[model samples]
Target: MSISHRQTASGRPLRVAPAWVGAATPVAGSPADHHPLPVRDAVWIWSVRRFARLALWALPASAVLYGWFTLGVHVPPGPLPIALLAGWLAAVSLIALAGLLAGSRTRRIALTGLLITLAGATLLLPLAALPEESAAARVALAPGQVHTLVEAACAVSGAGVLLLGWAVFRSKLVNPADGVLLMLAAMTLGAGSYGVKPVPTVGALLLLAAGMGLAWTGGRLLPRA
Candidate 1:
């Protein structure tokens, strides 16, 4: 008997043997048939999840750097600092997505859009790092223009975090207190100082709290299933 095969949407190939072979094939009641995650796909998913979990730690580290900067410790304007901060943004967005996978469709869509917006905001960091009057053509933007662009990026990043916080609150998957802390953190973290001293400092503290809280929450719950 000739055998045929078809691929599932998951890209796993399913054998379609002749009717006479049905008795020999694995039954629907078999454990393998009930949960058919192949070894390769399972490994890939586990690796991604592991990376995401590890990335969440970046939040706390980034918070410390941000705290230092906002508290008047001068970090020289450079690409390294900007890249590190951007990486934290990406990490937080990924963690948020991972946590809310079981949430409502609307929440998922909104979170996805927010992640895209946050990514756009992240791209502005390298531009913000450029000096006002650099010898290189890449740093052509005027200082004022670069400042404005960075501020805009900050605004977008804050908005994305705010929306995500709201969605997390609505989902009620985690502690209500954690959700509230997240909202407060996003609010303070996003504030633009414009030369004001205490405002940004306090925001950084809140951000630190938010980061620690999220890391704790993820550690407690994310490893299951």
Candidate 2:
């Protein structure tokens, strides 16, 4: 996302608000906090909700990645997937950043765009599963076209996941653990790209494994209320 700062008439910082404040406000106190804190509860609740969405997304994403490796999926002999994924991220981030510029009133619109982007991306999996949709037909590469697609996509996803994480962290939209769920996102990316490097594939699998572990921990720790 683009860096934003308010400027005075003189061009110095105008002092609008810190990166930490956003949609959710701090309620006085909760049973969870021994001492009252403003946004702590809201933050955790938002995180759990976000995590649930991703975990749902991950199931199909995993299947798609697996097909990308062992199935008939192909990679572009050229550099399309990486570019495409990066482009998608850039576009999404731009919209989100624009919302940030508009202030609290426009935040919902910005967030809606982001969610749309994610929803669109998730839909790609089922379509990609089809023989016609596979990258194999698009560009004929060496041997492992599908694998290459996965790896490149993963790298792009890691970049995106990290950025989303930062967005959430700074916005105080969710807890740190929520960001941990995004780790699944990174591996989801890696799985797409894993075929490029065997070791990296292992690492990607490890990341997915770790993500599941963290998700489990999150479920245990998250408040039922």
Candidate 3:
């Protein structure tokens, strides 16, 4: 029987496999020879991806709900409205998280903006929960230092949103137009806070567009399976 031998670069003799066996064997360090993810790691990855996708889609739905309830229907500040608004804010937070997960180039900026926005939203929640007729609510809502603080919080939140929009604009994950829409949305929404007529509606529509754009980008992240 005849056998073949190969020499390594280091001058060592290397045994060559038979033609049939070599054809079936995968070459070391080849792409096909890579190890697969462990079950636990695989599951974790899948879960994270699923969460990102859901978060992206939720943004648009939450924006619509918030806008419709707060503006379209003029819902009074009560348990239902508060709950809806809270949900919307939560969804917005998730969208930020999804952006981070999507590996945006400006993830740090996005994260900072998210934290600032959450802080503002937190400060506003207690006031929103209070009954309008209550003395405490009246005091808080009165045109004074408390009202000024509220306005400042709103402005801070708007600034945070603007930062987030800028991050999105610079990120490679989504269309730049979406970021423009988001910035405009933040500005118009801030204007609405100051009693600008008909601007809130436009802001809500812009927000919807931005959210939809993010959702579209997220959908592309999912595996085709």
Say which candidate scores most in TM-score: 3
Residue 92: error of model 2 in Å?
19
lDDT of 1: 0.56
Off-target runs (Cα >4 Å) in candidate 1 are: 1-36, 74-110, 113-117, 134-143, 222-225
What is the clash count for each candidate, in the order shown? Answer: 0, 9, 0
Computed on alpha carbons, the lDDT of every model, listed in order, comes to: 0.56, 0.42, 0.63
Clashes of 3: 0
lDDT of 3 by residue, 160-196 (tens): 7887888888875567887898888878776666876
Q: Pairs clashing in candidate 3? A: none
Candidate 1 displacement at residue 167 in angstroms: 2.8
- Clash total of candidate 1: 0
Clashing pairs in model 1, backbone N/Cα/C closer than 3 A: none
Whichever of 1 and 3 has more lDDT, that candidate is 3
Superposing all C-alpha atoms, what RMSD in Å does each candidate have to the true structure? 9.1, 14.3, 11.5
